[model samples]
Target: MPSDGFRGLVYGDWHFLEETTSKSKDSHVSSNYAYSMGIALRGAHYKVYPELKYDSVKPMLFQKHAAMSINLRNTQPMMLQNVQMKAVITKQGVFSQKRIFSVNNSKIAPNSIVTLPVQWQFDELKPGKYKVQVQVKGENDWNKLPMTWKFIKNIKVDKKAADNINDKIMRKPINKWFYISMATGGLMLISLVELLKLLLTGSK
Candidate 1:
């Protein structure tokens, strides 16, 4: 009642209508109501949280394009709305390119997990440990502040792959500002079977 909170009504087994009070989270009534309220409010920030994991089917990359997957789980009390992700590829700690991927289902129900198949296209990465960083955001009307989570994974490229990418690297780098400004659903995924067919055709 003292803070900017919603008013509550009585809901119980008794027939009489009365205001609701809590001895919540292992507290005794003799200590007064402030103790219980303080504990619950203090833990409010921990109420809404999500889990994220990134994996690559081809961890040891051989060429320009690779297949990876993302596992996202909604472990909170509310439904996650318009859940989306942005992935970036970086070398020497500076990101080279970025792509935004939309979830198949815009609304993720509470306690539900979704696996997104990620197709990465970076023809400029050399033979080294380049980091793939992914950021996920949760959009809901009840979320007053921005909710986001980030995860990173490194991919190794052998000499064969490095040479292939080197031959295809563009002369000028794409401006980072330009990449950020032009946000679009430009990411596309091609199946592994089709990729093999293309490679085999090129060899002929």
Candidate 2:
């Protein structure tokens, strides 16, 4: 006969329980083993963090062009595939016409970080507060499931400043044209003087 401790337990094809109590049926026991295992498996497939770096330290002032840096760091043990990065801009609270930019079907190796450069032209945007969102999506090594992440930032636009910048940019070509015209006129005058001197010398 088996011991009293093992009396209620069956030996064949039986499952093991850490401990048993009189009230075991009424009590609840939770284990994180499944959760940890899931995380471990997913970690081998797809895991990453997204970060955004603006061009300037100060709050962004509205201009003809705005730029930022995007970074993705893979925390997984295996390489990730079909990685896509997309940026969206909203004016006040409304979505812009379309996505600002996107990098599709990229690949990232395990524990590696990637940087993407992005630029937005806001000449048509009015002075106000705008929201910029960056999203990253990718497939795991197994390609069974997809993962997604996002980062957000707020930007302030100043029309006066933007106009000043635009004006300066516009004036540059005009200034160059003016300088070229002046040089051409000077050269023509020199040529005219030389031609007149040659003509007079020939007549003499």
Candidate 3:
């Protein structure tokens, strides 16, 4: 039996050889015994996949905040416990940011699927291409077997367009007020000019 509570192979054999000179001696025989024990094996398999969503029309364009959904499935027959989830964001293969989330001492039954959602903000990120990677690790209560999963996604950032959208949302009312003020000032100036012309003609 292995440390993972699995048994692989157990073998035993016995062999005996008879002596030729039985008349000279009372009886003589040779015997041999063999035994082999194999190491114990651990069994736990997991399937991990990632899904990404953005507010922009283009899936590749990541603006504002992006939602990362991670799907985990237990493909083995054993239950997995103490699952830990981690996510990392990179810019052109360079390290950018990372986040860690855990499932405590929970157990995921066999053939069961779980979805985890993570939010990433791009407000502070500069305009460029980025890579998002998600990782999941699980261990049994006995701590004998460990399972892991990793996934990656590519995205492009348009800081200029994001800034424009933000500016429009923030200053929409202010722009409307400015336009109204300009139209009113123009009308008042035109009326003053007409009054001044009438006064000049009267004086002449």
Q: Identify the candidate with maximal lDDT.
A: 2
For residues 1-204, write the lDDT of model 3, one tens digit per residue.
335543222122344445443343554654444454533233442222222222222222223344334556654445556767665555564646553334555555544566554444443334567676666667653333686767767877687754544443322134687899999999999999999999999999
Write out the backbone clash pairs for model 3: 2-40
Per residue, candidate 1 scores C-alpha lDDT tens digits across 1-204 of 225432211111223334456556775543322222211122234345444444342222333354334556655444555666666555444545443445533554544565554444554445556666777776642453456778777776676765664565444556988776555323323455678889999999
In model 1, where do residues sit more than 4 Å from their true spots?
A: 1-66, 91-105, 120-128, 140-145, 155-204
Residue 173 alpha-carbon offset, candidate 1, angstroms: 27
TM-score for each of the candidates: 0.35, 0.38, 0.34
lDDT for each of the candidates? 0.50, 0.54, 0.51
For residue 67, model 2's alpha carbon misses the true position, in angstroms, by: 1.2
Better of 1 and 2 by lDDT: 2
Between candidates 1 and 2, the TM-score winner = 2
How would you order the candidates by TM-score, starting with the best? 2, 1, 3
Residues 1-204 of candidate 2 have per-residue lDDT tens digits of 333322111212233445433345665774432211112223321333322223321222233344334555655445556888887656674644432668898865555566554544544335567667777777655543577777777777678754544453312124778899999999999999999999999999
After superposition, the stretches of candidate 3 with alpha carbons farther than 4 Å from their true spots are: 1-66, 91-106, 121-129, 141-144, 152-204
